[model samples]
Target: MGTTHDEAAGPRRRSLLQAAVGGSAAAAAAGATTLTGQAAAAPAGTAAAPRSGGRFDGESPRFALAVLPDTQYLFDADSADPDPLRATFRYLVAERADTNIAFMTHLGDVTEHGTEDEIELAADTFGELDGKVPYSVLAGNHDVSGSDDQRGDSAYLRAFGPDRYARMPTFGGASPDGYNSFHTLRAAGRDWLVLALDWRVSDNGLRWAQRVLDDHPTLPAVLTTHDLAWAEDDGEARLSDNGRRLWDGLIRGNDQIFLALGGHYWPPGRTVLTNDAGNDVHVHLTNYQDRYYGGAAMIRLYAFDLARGAVDVETFAPWFLTRDPERRTPLEAENVELTGPADRFGLEIDFAARFAGFSPVPAPEPRPASDVLVRGTVAYWRFDRAGLPGAADEGAPVADGRVVRDLSGHGNDLTARRLHTSGDGALTWSAEHHVGQPAHASLRFDGGQGPDRGALLSTRRDAPLNATRFTGGYTIETFLKLPEPFVGEHAWMGVLSWEGRSGDAGKTTGWSTEEPTCSLNVSPERFLQFVVYPHVQDADPTSWSHALPVGRWTHVALVNDGRRTVMYVDGSRIARNPTQRSTGIATLGKPFVIGGTQFAERYGQGFYGWIGDTRIVDRPLTPRQFLTPYR
Candidate 1:
């Protein structure tokens, strides 16, 4: 219950609090309460009224949680003023839709003394959010009579006990002594638990917290308490004596407890600790009572973005923000937003992987080959059949002459071949594939460009795909992932190409006469290049894409109608597609190559990455018809 400030500067009382109390009284006399609307229509026992449109979209991948900490000075009995806290609640109510706020939490210290007048005043002010937003509050050292939860029946308990939240949707259950509680919020297509613990939890209280976690074993838990850590002026926080006991008793062994938040410390700080499961547990301290106007009821927002695997934090004072900018004091302007490292930051967490231990996300099953064989499909090849006679097993090197049958029921089979100076390990089968890919496996090529050595797969000389040209339209689609640290030698690698040079095909409108007629290649800058020599015109329509991300799977589609061609990366059209008219692919009736393009009818450096399911159609197909479904 004590802090370093108590030892260094006598007591915890600040002259700033006295000044803030007098100023708050003057602001209240000036009709500041009119800034916020009337109190909530319903009390704490009814269903919350929805906003203008509807309730917040909890199922969205992006949502926010609001945190209010240490508002004791504002609720001191004689000098109490509820305008600041009311403004914060009003802001949460108005911005609920835009922010997608799921729930709000109060880290205790709601009043300076455990008196009925102080607790009742705080309760009446909080009525502004009774049915508007779901919130939970716990007792702090100042809220109680400097005793643990074992000392029951206080004014704080009578005002904010489990009975006050029994009808709320998020309220789960409370301990028998009524000092601790837990709530479950449905967000991000799942449930998240928020545990509110008393200032000084007794042994029974600790057991109650454990029981709550045991009941909901799979849900991620966030523990909120009154005092856990303290920080110096440098904003580096360390565990207090009570914080260490709580960590050893509750947080260190619970893998589901990924975050712990507390108040009762100034100049908010944070630190990350490793749990018994070897996972990071973020412990943060947030309290602004020492700032201007008792921190003006500042709110800290935790914006959880599941798609980005990050929780972005921002702290600001809604009360100060409502003031006229021209009339605001220097302190008020400075306290509008906290830009310090500890106040605004992002926590990088792979949510799926981090929660896999308790609740595993099932991997999608492999789709049947027939599911993706569209109407105009000419050839479709997948490297998923590992145990077949001619196919290589997962992690095994592909044989020199492995024949991969075309799944389109056409005789466009491909044969694997090793380059002159490459080893048997040049090509291998892998189980890594994109999440939305139909196939569950891919081919990893260890190719480079020093002496032009690698591996490739090519259709036979007499294959029908080699002779036939798609005059109507064409669609080429593939899934690939480049290596993380793509080396310089792997630059200008080819993914797929039609064998034979454009000069041999009687076409000259290209960068180089020796280049393949139709090829999909990666440039030195990691941009995708789709260059095609058409039969109807002498122009080569080239489509260049933005730089592809390294170590990430990407779906590429090259669609050409009867007139023009368009290239799509991950279903989005690139910006650099040429406007040149292109109709039929110029073929030399020799062979169609994959994994590498030919220079002067000879294979050079092969593709140096993992390639998944690839398909080519005779007519142009929309993005929805591609192998991977586009959202």
Candidate 2:
């Protein structure tokens, strides 16, 4: 996945993540000022606690940790000011005993070049906090050499070696006398094993990490590396080579691995992936090396509220605090000089759900049609004929093997126009994917060159079900499993849509010139978006807050109550329209299409995944009803 942005720096930034990387008048002032003056400016002991502007409203964590992004900015040969980097470490030393900070973590790139001088400066700068706080320093591409291929030899270890860490009792171990290492910390009634992996860890490194994970199966693990997760030009999250390999070889299978942290990419990013055990592994990437003059002394303060199962991340510039007040953005400005959402945010991490001996519900039972009938369903499509387990019709076509049966009994059968065909001269039925309901079939769409373009259309040519009939209220719900790699992009990958025909060129939907009636689709970010015609009312397009987890079964429901429309994922309400529209759909008669959509023309770059039971409720479903499992 990639994130789209201008390659040219924004007005205040040299790169996307460099929004907070500018050198201000404060830097000059710090350079000219004496150490005694800097110390007095914020008085490290109480010196400007993490700006109380984060989501938690400044609520301090039970324990916190500071994440130091690349310090290459500190040693850049082109930069004259060294005060920012030193000030950063000095602030840490001052607050080490003040804040309940257990330790600090460095995401690598300790120096500009793997040169002896740079490494020495780094060691001396960081050494200030050597015994003051427990910390882990990872190796970045820059730390090794001028280029990734030209890895440096032993300069880093010579500067900060085992002897530097030997004083700490929690120091678990290191890689054959190298920077790759792990440390232990106790919090929330649990011991956390934090692993700092080098920039390009070798096969041995992976094995060593796995052994560490295996040895401490009872402890929650946090992984840190130089480069890992990042947002490409497309705005989708992607893993680097080392990152993917690490996940495949080490992180994925380990149930105790809870968080993966990284930097080195220009833009800060985040993505949550579930391991095979259905546990979420939070991956975060933050770096500001692209900022002007090697970026300001901004650092991330992660306050872990273990009891609340949340981590409130705050970005602060301790150096900027010592500058004249008028030179910087007021602390009240949400900008915090870091322009994007990734600079600060809160995440809910339910450790109990991941670590508390959880097990999958075996052979989940199916939800019966009676459940929908009682809820006044107007239309339903259960692709029962496809993928039927152990049945003669299993792996057969809709009419030949699977039956496109409607649960509502309104005679609206679906035609699997384009589906995955098997190489054995028969369509393959998946037996392992069925969830919540045993032996229930689900339609799979191949995001390839297939006839009908991987879409399922209503067999009924005169499908009377349109948004016009439900102006008062209605709901569309389905059980969906997103593709493993996520197949769609900037454009729409239709889950379901009803729109004006191409022949009706003059027809217009309030939101779009062609898309009318109603369409429910997933955005590139994977959030659900429900659209009603002419959804141009500034609030016409309402989307969910949570992105549907890929490769997992999830229930998505969209409800509109005449005025307000809301989206629900799983069984929780995620988002709702901020402004209610008084007018309903202007155009209606188009036939409903599944797996893809149609607006001006058939907008079917159809979704590639599985869709289980899809139902259209005649009335808006309550939150309780929306929470109903696909069973």
Candidate 3:
């Protein structure tokens, strides 16, 4: 972790998510390039771009790498000034401190037309950054002079040849035309190599990328191409033309290449897969070139903060200077409308920890759910094993690391997808605390941490768990114990929620309202609450009931039987709300979320304590059936 800015004032670590951090050190400490780069800048008649929100300390060992997706808009023939593109580089120079920005990568499409003027625009803008910080660029489909079939990026090479990057310590080698290359850098005491390839890599080019990885076997690698992963309707990512070939031919065997990044396919998507060697490979796709004026000058920031055991990702457009409307024109000049959750969020990934035996691969075998009381269990998670088969394994299972095992007949297992990608080892299984009734382990969720870092379980939305088409009453139950010190805090905490996105449950869906199937929450006043959307608003004064006992094992359950809804605590009715004569639960399009919902605000408000057996049945349980004693 980096030391605080003012150590003498009082030793305190800077806020991991807040606190703006850079501006080219004082004149005396400014490096030669920092001074020369800004001095040589052309007068931007327009207002300056806004400062990026991401910040870091001047002396922090943690670093960030900025990914500048498709800059084809900067090369637009209709543009009055190429200020957006220029602003991106300037933003880097301004926020250089907070970011500890080690490198910048352009995911190709640097030009709309392969003309000399456009090429120079990119070259000159990047040139200003040339001496200050090392950067690399990959060729996109639009980078060449001719159509796709006649593609050739000779101009791109001439502008960014070997000579241009020879001084960079990490520069490994590049193709003659500079369409393919690699760079090496260090973060969190680990070495990394970034390989850049053309829009469509040839067989020879693939071999070159492979050879680069072969030569630097000790270094982790990130491959940048023009087009790779694309989003699918099912929410899973599928590879494109070049992507498929690269994966099968080059990436499949290379254990060193952990991340494959690309642009060109719009609507960003990400997926992680385990290679033949059991190493987790993360593939990410980002492209804003088709949105407002070719992506509204947005850039992706990958902040690797090992101290927090997570990677904080942010998307900010330094060029979208909206504070001063006079300068905040959408397309003509600086963009003004691009800030949203889709563009910014922290993903829990602690690469440093993962590199140190924090394997992303699941254990080969995991324990199955133990036979116990309470029939009609449609989905369950014991958190006992660490393999895919999990609680569903028919054979005797072996305990691996921590895993959220789904004991339900349906394999609706939970996984920390975002956290895994960002490199955090998600949940760590604990045997210290649990309701030993079923003789199963539990999971401890540490609250008030970074985004989605709380104790939560995420399972993919599948048919068996798809509540969207259900027409029956339902029951949800969980055993949890809150820590003694956590009850009085005036912050909302989540118990369980169901939806597509992460945290809060209720969300708008199309023309019709899609209330969360249900949400089990703990209010700021320590009250156990149950909320059903559409029929019940979140702000309803009666959303909650009496206070729950603190620091004690408690079993909470919610049962809806076609009309009225009743809440139970430790097998006793605690609260009830009579509802209109309607179907008990609304079908949801998202997955079942345990411990937390997908609402962004309550992202870190996960239950802080031990969560024992959690089970959900499609039908409501009778009072007697619900309180059955455990063996």
Candidate 4:
């Protein structure tokens, strides 16, 4: 059985039933008992807003999972009021497209009593989501007669049995007793499992859950139940006795179970536990029945951003949102959204690495040089040959004076050169490369300012690339990642640039005459800056990009189609591309440099990051022709 707590322990917990009906008294008096009662309360002849159907984007890297917890207080047998719950359902249905809500899961305690009247009302209210959103529900202690899934023939089971979800695409299966169920939602290009377990699951139920895990061994799972944990005033949650039992019998042993959610306890909280596989399992308890207006039908949205490897959680009361802001009471306004640490927060999980044990994401193999040698390719340099017989091993210092052959057959080979005062460890070979990069290795630069220390690879004094200017157009592509704690001293470091000064090229329109004719650099704020001095025009057209996230590999491309320049990061065109004409690059007969910029023919600092395969083309190429394949 779920742990019982006082619903009205203090003045703050007193019921707001009367206050909630202040302006909507006429609607409350109408006593409309259907799921659409809230809509019926609207003006005559107006139909309820349409629900979002067939709008979910399951393959999006970013999506949301809606969680409704403990609506028991709103479904009491005689005082039943389904308006609040209906309002929440409407909100989820309307925002489904904008939020990319893949699925909804109700943490059980759907009614105040185990009576047929209450369960029936609750079930009817849920009809608002019947065909629109896929969801799962289970029996709470309040909705069952006895303490286990084996307890037969309850109102909750009769209303939410396998028959209720047999037609749903996400429904996987239900236990024989129809009290425990599992759902498989296709999201983020993969299948995810949601286990809706009874408040008191029997040993037989646990065995059934194990079988489900065995059937789909690769799907990450979220275990949901009614009774799991209780939180203290400070919002630190501790597992209840029943929760401990579930952990021991089902969750802790299953490597695929990464998140566990429950709602029987008040004062929502969360904690992290280590499973037998030594992976983290996030255990969360969310419930607000003790709050004003029976918790106001609050819903929690877990926004999963796979690219960022994080889940942003937000709790808000949709019922309050449906109310008029100008007529809302102070309490109603306060309950609209929750910003407390325990209620709203973010969880970071490296999805690929976390699921690697069960579903390993294969690393892309290095592409052949011939594959990326697109038309008009002038230069292509890749460090993937590291660990070869004559090359530096992974993580080993790049030897001074080592030569890197240009794969384009352009005879523009580059040679590694260490700064006069820098140490041998200034640069090293790294096996870490972008997931989509053609190469599987990169070069790590440990350069810094204040003394101008680092190593760089530069073309020979007479290399053809240093003298040829792309009059028709040009494309420069490179995959790079900034250090996690990019220090202040490493600000304004250069990733790649031409070696000659703009002044030397006779082009004076630039941030500085001493600066390079063309350069790609990281500003102090980590913004990507692409500046070029055009040969046909004296104006320097510069393209600035949003701040790049540290510690994540990014593919950057600068495409100039003879007229204007556009910068693309990870295949998406940035908003700050310059409109000024940029016909051709101004060049001097000097060595082109990578890993550092030159000011008046002097290196101030080398790049403090990892640089992967780089390619330069004399003609502007589409994203499909870039080294890193665009998705």
Give all candidate RMSDs, comma-separated.
Answer: 6.9, 13.8, 21.2, 5.4
Candidate 2 local lDDT, residue 357: 46
Candidate 1 residue lDDT tens string, 1-631: 3244445446554432222222322342232432122122232223234345237887888889999999988988898888889878878887777788899999999998868999999999888778878999999988898468988799999999998898889999999999999999998889999999998899899999999999999999999999888876666778887788889999998899999999987767899999999999999999988887787899999999997799988777777656654456667656666767788788999998888888778988899888888998999888877212345567799888888778898889888889878987788888889888998888888888888888888898889899778889999999999999887587778999998889988787688889889999999999999999987888789999999999989999999897888999988899999998998888889788778888787877899899998899989988878787664
What overall lDDT, based on C-alpha atoms, would model 3 receive against the true structure? 0.60
The stretch of ten residues in a row with the least summed lDDT in candidate 3 is: 27-36
Model 1 clash pairs?
none
Q: Give per-residue CA lDDT, model 4, range 1-631, as digits (tens).
A: 2333433233344232222232223333342321212332233323246445448888889888888999888988778789889888887887787788898999988888878899888889999888888999988878887869999887788899999999899999999989999999988889999999999999999999999999999899999999988776566778888899999998999989999999987778899999998999999998888778878789988999998899988777767655555455677756766667787789999999888888888888778888888989999988867322254577798888888889898988989988868887788888899999887888888899888888899999989999878889999999999888777597888999999889888887787899989999999888999999998899889999999999899999999898988999998899998889888889887888889988888888888989988999988888887787665
Angstrom error at residue 440, model 4: 1.5
What TM-score fits each model?
A: 0.83, 0.48, 0.48, 0.88
- In model 1, the runs with Cα more than 4 Å from the true position are 1-55, 324-327, 374-376, 386-390, 461-475, 500-514, 530-552, 557-591, 599-602, 617-631
User: Candidate 2 — what's its lDDT?
Assistant: 0.62
Candidate 3 regions off by >4 Å? 1-61, 77-80, 145-153, 232-236, 322-342, 350-353, 356-631
Best first by TM-score, ranked: 4, 1, 2, 3
Identify the runs in model 2 with alpha carbons over 4 angstroms from their true place.
1-61, 78-80, 146-153, 233-236, 328-339, 358-631
